[model samples]
Target chain A: AQSVTQLDSQVPVFEEAPVELRCNYSSSVSVYLFWYVQYPNQGLQLLLKYLSGSTLVKGINGFEAEFNKSQTSFHLRKPSVHISDTAEYFCAVTPRGTQGGSEKLVFGKGTKLTVNP
Target chain B: NAGVTQTPKFRVLKTGQSMTLLCAQDMNHEYMYWYRQDPGMGLRLIHYSVGEGTTAKGEVPDGYNVSRLKKQNFLLGLESAAPSQTSVYFCASSYTGMGPETQYFGPGTRLLVL
Candidate 1:
């Protein structure tokens, strides 16, 4: 089994400021990583994913995440944030070959991002 | 087309009550999942189906039952609702294989157990 840990329970930043949400995972074997965003009263939407690619993977809404193999971390970052970026973010992981014939994610406890105006 | 839809956007159930949440996907996806989200807790898998008539337990399966009687629909049922089961439920589906397959989620169903 694989587990994901999000170091931050909440992150608050002023508008136009840069922010980073840290995520770490524990897996005995190779895995896939993903970042998801959930607005108030809405389901989660995929922000980015790390399958097999470059260490730095860009995603929607000007967000990006770097997959660090050695550290077992995939932290999401944004150069600048806006008020609309205030939402709950979750980091998820799945074993390479155990994705229910697809990729099934095991999510973290979530980090609430508050982009203050 | 509707990607994934979960019926009964909100519900209020009492302890020991029974209810079922329906999830339907129009994308012809082969894999479907049920997950619950709570405050400070991200999404936890309740159950999943690889195909019609095949259900598998996920990370958290207690107090829940699932059935995939049709290819496009997956149902999550609570035989005896408990306070612990009050949470937002989400349904997601994805295509099979490694073809950039990412799960598409439903809007969600908010259930409150009193």
Candidate 2:
């Protein structure tokens, strides 16, 4: 079974400081990866995704993630973060294949990103 | 557009009671999903609908039932609610269930089974 692991449960950073949230996955087959953000009391919003090609994937709000196949990791990062960027982040993976089967995304436990001013 | 909306932003149910949570989307998506968000467990899929009249079980579907009678609506029912069933429910939809497709989410419904 495909699984995702978010290394950090909480990460606190000073305002305008760079940050990195580590994510790793275990899958036997080819997989697609994604990062999602959830604000306080709100639903999730897609940050970025890695389907194929381009190891570096850029997402909304100046965030980017590098998909390293060898490491089985897709880590999210931002050059600088604002107070509004403080939210819970999730890493999800979906194994390649949709022929008469569920193509559901398997999510990690989540990392709470806190941008302190 | 309203995008995706879930009815009854919050609900409290007693054990053994039955209630249904409704999820509606306006994007004309062919794929809809129901997931329960629990602390430390992340989001686990309970059920999904590929199209109208077709529903499938997901990773965690034992305590829930679903119906997709209409293209825009997906209902999740708990025949006999349990305290363990309490969690934040999210509804998501995508154009298709293929690789890398984005799933638009609803605000979510907080259900408490007391």
Candidate 3:
């Protein structure tokens, strides 16, 4: 079994300021981590994912995340934020075995990012 | 291309009323999933299907049932609606079983129970 935890519940930042959303996970086996963003009343959009080979992964919208195995963390970061970046972000994880099917994804409670101008 | 589509964008249900939400994907993907999003909480998986005629339970599946009669479609059913079941429902699809699992999501259906 795999579970994810997002440290912050809400973060308010001024536009153009840098932001970091922390995430941690617990799993007995290898795991795959992902970050997703949801706009107001909209479905989720994939922010980034950490599969293998690279600890730092980049995604669309100038967002990036670094996977640290020892720390059990996959934190998302952006050098600068925009007002349009205001939304809810979720971190998810799944184990890496056959029994760990692709059907299941354990998610964090989510962190609401409010970018104010 | 409509990667994924969910029917009934919004609905209001009374207690004990039953309804089914339909999700379809034109991507010919091998994996499909149903999830619910609520305030303060992130999305939780309700059910999923890996292929045609195959279904599996997810993190929160007690109040829901799912069917995958065909590869292109997955249906989520509420046998008896309850206030606790009101949330935004999303459907997603992925292409394969490994590496950088990028699942494309639908627009989502907002359901309110009163």
Q: Which candidate number maximizes TM-score?
A: 2
DockQ of each: 0.58, 0.60, 0.60
lDDT of 3 by residue, B43-98 (tens): 88899888999988888999899999989999999999999999999999999755
For residues A1-117, could you state the per-residue lDDT of candidate 3 as single tens digits? Answer: 778889999999999999999999999988889999989877788898888888999998999999999999999999999999999999988787675656657789999999999
Local accuracy by lDDT, each model: 0.90, 0.93, 0.90
C-alpha lDDT (0 to 100) for residue A94 of candidate 2? 87
Q: What's model 2's lDDT at B47?
A: 94
| Worst window of 10 by summed lDDT in candidate 3 chain A | A96-105
Question: Lowest summed lDDT over 10 consecutive residues: which window, candidate 1 chain B?
Answer: B94-103
Q: Taking candidate 1, what TM-score does its chain B reach relative to the real chain B?
A: 0.96
* DockQ category of candidate 3: medium
The local lDDT score (0 to 100) that residue A17 gets in candidate 2 is 97
Instruction: For residue A105, give model 3's deviation from the true position in Å.
Output: 1.6
Q: How many backbone clashes does candidate 1 have?
A: 0
Where does candidate 3 clash, by residue pair? none
Which segments of model 3 are wrong by more than 4 Å? none
